[model samples]
Target: MSWQMADIWENIAQAIPDKPAIVDGDKRYSWAEYEDRAARVAQVYTDHGLKPGAKLAIYSYNSAEYMEAQFGAFKARICPVNVNYRYLEAELTHVINNSDSEALVYQAQFAPRVAAIREQLEHVKLFLEIADGSGEHLDGAVDYETALQAASPMPVIERSDDDLYMLYTGGTTGMPKGVMYDHKTFSSALFTKGFEMREMTLPEGAAGFGPLTQALHAADAATRSIPACPIMHGTGMWIGAMIPHALGGCVVLFDNSHFDPAALWKLTQDEKVTDLTIVGDVFAKPMLAALDDAQAAGKPFDLSSLQMMGSSGVMWSAEVKKGLLEHIEMVIIDSMGSTEGSMGASVTTRETTESDKTASFDMAETTRILTEDGKPVAPGSGDIGLICNGGMVPLGYYKDEKKSAETFRTFDGVRYSIPGDYATVEADGSVTLLGRGSICINSGGEKIFPEEVEEVLKTHDSVYDCLVVGVPDDRFGEKITAVLSVSKGTQFDEGALNDHVRANLAAYKTPRAFITVKDVPRAANGKAGYKDAKEIALNALNLEVA
Candidate 1:
């Protein structure tokens, strides 16, 4: 109960001072240096008059600095709030104001947006800027490196179990809210996941971490994870960075400004990465294409070192996993979770590929499928219910008691985090994940999950990515629409795609209208952004859906 993230990490740094802690392109930081930098960042927090339980938002891309500030916030007992890098002025302002953040650490490239909304953010007292060579600077913002150089490292202090760790999630369905977790439960679950990833358990307590990490490193079994997505996302921060860091592994970040599959593959090969964190098929498809292209060019990446690739927050199609397996023999892990809590995960390998479906998962004992009336859904019954995670649930959403009570509630005297995700329990106690109930479309009195329809559409040979949304219709009350980004060098046939959907799903579930876009909107966390799709569909529904 006494184990703290920063405290354990400081001891790890003392034990493995010279070991690589983070790798980004040509630069690397050792464990001692990582700790020192984070401490200096904490100094900045202290200097800004931020006290215990104070909140600060991090607005930056994936960099070593992003993580240093997070760890620093932990040491200083400040709540680190993650701001999506893709958010516009309105969305950014809502997150900062909603979270009650007093300080901001932003990348220089995003200075314009910050400066634009800086005046509106009256609660924010400090702005710490990280420079990119882009020469984008903001007035009244403290330069990151300059501050670290000017300030002495803030010494470590005892931290409380109730200290906060906040992750913002809404994923385009609505405005993002900060999901709150106490340090005690969050870090405990994180360490459990990290050790489970290695097929081991924690030795005992904080005292055993130094020896365990040293032995693992000596045995050449240190975890090296690549957070292929933006670190602002929970998947990137929790699974990719914090978990691996807690286990004393070096986190390898992509050096590319944009998502380049070739760059990611080369980074994994160069770093001998043991695991990677991605957001389902959205990332897997492009990465698989890169492997094919690179191999055809007579320069296949050396992916023999990669042991596992994990995806969450979106669909990871079965075919995509098979395609990746064709190139490298690695485990494909699909995790189902949101900022609220982890529901379940499924692992697919070459041998198990035939039996794996895109959305099926094996649940932990703490997770249960419950009906609206507080009864557990019987296995083998075709009943759908909210997938509730029972143990170690979030305290609640920050600053929204109504939402908190609705999301994190007590069902039959046990607290659970049920974020409106509906699913059914199989006879074997596994789950068939339908989708989020909030986004489900009701057409002609029949409910249809968009993810179920989207999965069928993505199976088309011409489709690259697709999002399904319900649009207003006079007859059906709501019409199903498809927003697609076609595959490269291919043309889309709405009729053929509709037929494909009908083949796999019910006729009513098939999209009533089809529209093409250059890109399907997704949150920074790689989850579907349905708002844009609905607007696009409704604007042209009358002309197209007849």
Candidate 2:
């Protein structure tokens, strides 16, 4: 039988009708109740003239309504676009216009931003605003809950396996481009092996079939997953939230807006969350600090219910990854993925050794690494370009044939999605992600990438966060500069930061100059906005373009 993404939910609702499906602080929804709410949301969409395959944009943070919108979109057969909550007016307008989104559902917190871009969003016909119990409303938007209440709770549409359910990639390099995925792609790429591998134990009869249904049921019964990341990025949308739901697990929403280690720990302990997905060092560092503070107080937090821990979004350093495992005493699965891919590019397993944990390669069999000349390279080859496959690789970038043709290519009669990532292929065939190739810096005669330097800089105790980039120079052609957000109470001295990097990295790779700031510029997904960072770096250095 063919796989249907919507069917995964149906199976869980039937098998575990009363099981907890989602939890947001004081609120909790059972599987049946969640489905009913999703059905009503679907009815609302249909009643508002959104047909199957129509584009609907969700511009909210992690919430019950966010999940409802996803399931509701599937039920209504509308293609849901997860808009980044942190996007400014220009960024938000670009996606809205590019995706040709017909309707937008957003929280009241972002009303001002929406109001700013509403005039520019030519394609958006309906604007749905979610109130934060403050009774505040955006001028030209309808109430979210009121619309749902007025709409019928009927499942108005049925989606086929080939119907596009997700638009995974948001084109940050240029304009946002949609990477369309169907129900079959979700079941095959995400459900089959991805969720199955995360389970501690499998049921007797649940071994062979797509483990998604059974996992959702078991997760709903046993585990509660805390998704700290926003729902716009694939890590936050698919791996962090949806997959947990596919397992019938409760999702704990961390809606603090900014990263607060103490608040996160308090939420986790209070919610009794069993599983947690850490994005990278930015997230993990604060969490570790909070844990340390708790330990120092002689009241070691009861994180006993925490069973499984994993890291995704950005790559975590070996030291940070080790620190987390040692502290938690649980297996840590570090993974690498891209927006063009269906989220699960590669993942480390429990049995993977410490040495293997540090080295980033262990990709699935379907994943491949090839050189610029299109020849495959052997494992342990220093740094080879990577192209991942299997699951729902995007059809093409929406509306940009030139980029679509270049990125989505056909080799050996099979189409492969290569989003310009470089990695090291280990002896055992695992892949270690280096960084994006497009942003790689060539300084003096050395090939330096910002990610490599940023990783080293993050290890510094005084540095809270930093972004590294290459600036045009007369002597070296391009010189490396580091812009940093230092820890509170720490001094921002360029000489001291230079010495720190010199101790860890090659002299040529270290940042030639440092600019201290309160925060590093980043996109909604915690990714460095290199262009923005470069602009800041150049202005600080008083460097002129040649």
Candidate 3:
């Protein structure tokens, strides 16, 4: 796994040339076609003076061209920076400029937005547009398809295992920052034994690459994954796109920019998608709703092809898991991971029994629960500790040494990345995750984490979704407020929900006020952007929030 991502793809393509690699809408690309197209993309970009180590920004929806751009950048030994499609013009410009991106590959539909901010991107030299039938083009941009067709497939360039793989994320707080990961570290963690590319090692000689390639091709079944989230997000790109591709499997991309639950189900049924990666309950609610609709209409979509459904980066409640379990017989994988580090823990649930509990995970070997003072917490200690990961962590946040030094650290000579997730190790060796420390509420000197309270609120049948934030308080310093949406026929019984929380958790931890909204605002990836939610709450309370 010390090889660059592009070289590995080349090796896999040589052995399994005809295996389907990517599917977007009606178009399907085989392994050979995928490699060839990626190479052509590489050629075109390199021809335009795109050099190795230069940053290339991908600002588009989920499409085959997105994947091609990613592979192309890797083959050219360039770093691909993921741009949040939801960003406003200022934010988008900030990301591109901050990343020092030399080129951009975006969708034709977004040409206007790109044009509006094109002058702000002083370092950008190339703009390759993917046609979405918008018929709008930038002044100096090249058509993505035309450029690929015109250029020869690039010869494999020199690449290093240490070549950067950059992903920009707004992890837990603040604006987005680029997290730089070398290929070897990212590939090793992603292509684990579970992914069927166990312990990827560089060959002793040229002969060794063949054996690994043959082994990859000899697999009887290939894993097919569909990411319901935008490919720009970590869950979509890493879990949905990269992992499946590394296994010599097919990645199915949703054609629409918006999430269509029915279309997701249809794609899974049609493609026999083995894995569906989502963010959390925002995605689950609609998907579950679609399933209910289909069943009631006497045309239930066949999800029998799915073996597992995984969610990360947000809360995935046990109630939603049970709802999905009733329809599909597959494992529900609830993972605790971050842009700054690899997965710390995972809770896998099957229909047979309740093995996965909400907010609880069996820790990975590379992770440990440590006290703030840097001492490991013993099981059953009941002491709150930060979840720290040892091996396979990112180098650091790109170019922000002070921030990077705070998040990634060396403790007693072993380096660890602590993304500020606080948790308690249970007596049974399970980790019960509290929410991020950055979002924790300190009310009257007692710290209350939002996820713990939110999870308790979700257990009530009347509640559809909820977000807990601390509001400015005169006496208590900050009062806990739960802003939530109720199920369509259920009344907003604040007292009942309050009683439920008081019973499950401490009285002080219960939300002092409950506000009912039509819906909680969520990102496309299904994460409740707490900063925005908090701002909304502050306005409702007539209190100022920082």
RMSD of each: 1.9, 3.2, 2.2
Candidate 1: tens digits of C-alpha lDDT, residues 220-280: 8888999998888889888888888878899998753578888899889988999999998
Each candidate's clash count: 0, 13, 1
Instruction: State the weakest 10-residue window (summed lDDT) of model 1.
Output: 537-546
- Best lDDT goes to which candidate? 1
| Model 2 alpha-carbon miss at residue 210, Å | 11
Candidate 1: C-alpha RMSD to true structure equals 1.9
Ranking by lDDT: 1, 3, 2
Q: Write the per-residue lDDT of candidate 2 for residues 129-184, one digit (tens) a residue.
A: 88877456788688889988887786534457787765646544765677766667
Off by over 4 Å in 1: 489-491, 542-546
Q: For model 3, what is the alpha-carbon lDDT of residue 77? A: 95
Error of 1 at 160 (Å): 1.2
- In model 2, the runs with Cα more than 4 Å from the true position are 168-172, 199-221, 342-359, 487-506
Cα shift from native, residue 136, model 1 (Å): 1.7
Q: Of the pair 1 and 2, which is ahead by TM-score?
A: 1
lDDT of each: 0.87, 0.72, 0.84
Best TM-score goes to which candidate?
1
Please estimate how well model 1 matches the true structure, expressed as its whole-model Cα lDDT: 0.87
